[model samples]
Target: MADILSILLSDSFWAAALRIATPLIFGVLGALLCERSGVLNLGIEGIFVAGAMTGWLAVWMGAPLWLGVLAAALAGAGFGLIHAILTVPLGLSQHVSGLGVTMLATSVAYFTYRTALPDVTSPPRITPFQPLDIPLLSDLPFVGPVLFQQTALTWLALGCVFLVWYVLNRMSLGVALRAVGDNPDAVDAQGLSVYGLRIGAVMAGSALMALGGAFLTMSAFDAFFFGMVNGRGWICIALVIFASWRPGKALLGALLFGAFDAFQVRLQTEVGAMVPGQVFLMAPYILSIIALVVAARGADYPRALLTPWFKGQR
Candidate 1:
């Protein structure tokens, strides 16, 4: 057991853990934004898939990798607009609208990927985003690769965690957003634009979702595939509740889940003589369920979450 623990604590293990956690961090960030603003974005799966496909498509078009990344963010925002249209403007059920957006986005991603890039047998693999090797720190033994030599996106994700924490806690916009989530009517009574704040929150959430997808295609996998998101969206939803709408906690949760996933894959490979890989693969799902259960016990979810705020409703 000590030997096994040592292997798990190796630099390579930590590096792989960070790599897997990147997408979750992005998704959780987006989820944090949406849920804090009283919107439950069940469409995270769709947004992720759309971003992957679009980012891949852009790469196929011979565009710069950064352009492909930007395209993914734009794709997310577009889908977010659709979500806002149905749930925010039309007063549709937030749950149904979110699911609908997911379904529609999924179809769009599949058909477009197939029809437009028919010759592509698999998702076109591109260069993984470049890693930044810190001059002094990257040379340190054991922890360098894991902490210092990660792709630019990893650093960005970390920065985003802090940025979001600040924005949600200290900024004026954050206060207004919380006001809208807690009671839009009161926010309206103050003559603030509830609609505008909601729109901004949705767009912000969608952009983060897109970045998460970009991490999968442009950094982690270097390619996209059908249903590539594979229920990660649901995981993000659970993570948001588990983190209690806190950005720092969201980052921590993502890393913990990522470590679990990394270990599952490693265990399956190392102990194939004893256990089935599928069982290990299911570990992350089990963790998600456990988290949801714990969070549901005494969670402080947004008071107005999933409640449609019609302008005319007093």
Candidate 2:
């Protein structure tokens, strides 16, 4: 018990929590954007895998690290367009379209990976981005090590939380977006294009989602492997609900989940003999389930979330 308490109080645990939460922040922000605009994108999982593959491949092929990130974002945007086509103009079920997107993206990534490197016994790896310690901030006691000692992408993820909130609450475009999600017919009546807004939102949101995946390969790990994402995308979905669709809350939620994951790792190492490994592994996911149940009450989802909008349909 004393050792566990000491571990929890140490700076290393908090730093690990931030590291674990970084990718999740990207994913949750992306999911939040899509859901806010009335699209529930289950395709996040596949997009994540695709981003990881594409970004790593770019870096492996001699492109700059930032370019690899761009490639991932673009690939994600392309997938989002496919989803928009299926769910927006074609008016297909969002649930079906999203799941289909996930399957299609993951399969394509797997096929490409196999075709590109069929005989390799060892996975190809690239030089991943190292942590860029902030100058003065990193010198601060406790806080600096925990927050400032992260990769560039992690810092960007933190900035995005504020950027998303600003755009959603203080921008005109955000108003139209929220309006479209709540009532597309009303938005259309006011001379705005519902299809355009939703498509834009989904594509933009998906690009961010892809960036999250790219972070996995380009920063979190130097190599891309099958199942590397390991359901972080799905966790982002739960996080959206747990956050009640708010960006600030999403950050807090992601941090909480990250803490659990970090603690689980510590537990595995420190108390492995007393507790089963599986319990530690499952701790984060179990907490997510509990969060979902707790946050569901009074949750205000977009009114037109699953409903396809038609020009004149009542």
Candidate 3:
């Protein structure tokens, strides 16, 4: 136990944990945005895989890494548009529509990555962006390297915490979004375009989710694999509930889950017999369950959640 604690103190542990948490952080933030706007995006997992496949395909095609990222974002936006068409325009169930999108994305990634390009592999799985070292801070004794030295996407994810906080808590657009989520009919009565705003929210949310996926394939893993997204998407869904739909709180949730996941790997490496590796791997889910219970005890979910908003109809 003492050795494990010591290992936890090392810069490598923190860096690895942060790297693992990056995608989840992005997905959680994206989920926060959509859920706060009264749109449920369950296709995060599928979108994530799609982004990975899309970005990887772009890189394999000799395009610049930034271009690959752009492709991933576009792919995500495309999925978001489909979500708006199904849920907002067609008045379909949010969960069903999101699930359908996820299924479609999974299929796209599969048939494309596995079926189409199995023979042509290139670039040797190296990510485009390199980790940046903050001049003074990165050289600090222990905490510096862990906190200051990270890939560009890690810094971007951290910045997004504050950015999302400002957007959701301090902006008029945010207030409007919250209003729509809480009471879509009331917002509609105010002469606001509910469908348009919700559509924007969905597209924005999907774009963020897609970026998270790209980060995994490009910066984190540097390659694409079938079902490579693991369950980060589902984990982000739980994070929204745990954070009570708040962006800042979602960061803390992402860290907690990230640490748990990190610890699980280390535990399995050191003491694989005492606790079944599977049980240790379940830590994130178990923590998510506990967090959900605590959060729901006093949660204030959007009033319009899962409720369809029809123009001029209460």
Give each model's whole-structure lDDT: 0.86, 0.90, 0.84
Of candidates 3 and 1, the better by TM-score: 1
**lDDT winner among the candidates?**
2
State, as a TM-score between 0 and 1, how close model 3 is to the true structure.
Answer: 0.93
By TM-score: ranked, best first: 2, 1, 3
Candidate 1: count the clashes: 0
Of the pair 1 and 2, which is ahead by lDDT? 2
* Per-residue lDDT value at 175 in model 2: 94
TM-score per model over all chains: 0.96, 0.97, 0.93
lDDT of 2 by residue, 91-113 (tens): 89998899999999999988998
* List of clashing residue pairs for candidate 3: none
How do these models rank on lDDT, best leading? 2, 1, 3
Q: Judged by TM-score relative to the true structure, which candidate is superior, 1 or 2? A: 2
Q: Give one digit per residue, the lDDT tens place, for model 1 in 1-87.
A: 775797687898889888888889989999889888888888888998898888878987788888988999999999988897777
- TM-score, prediction 2: 0.97
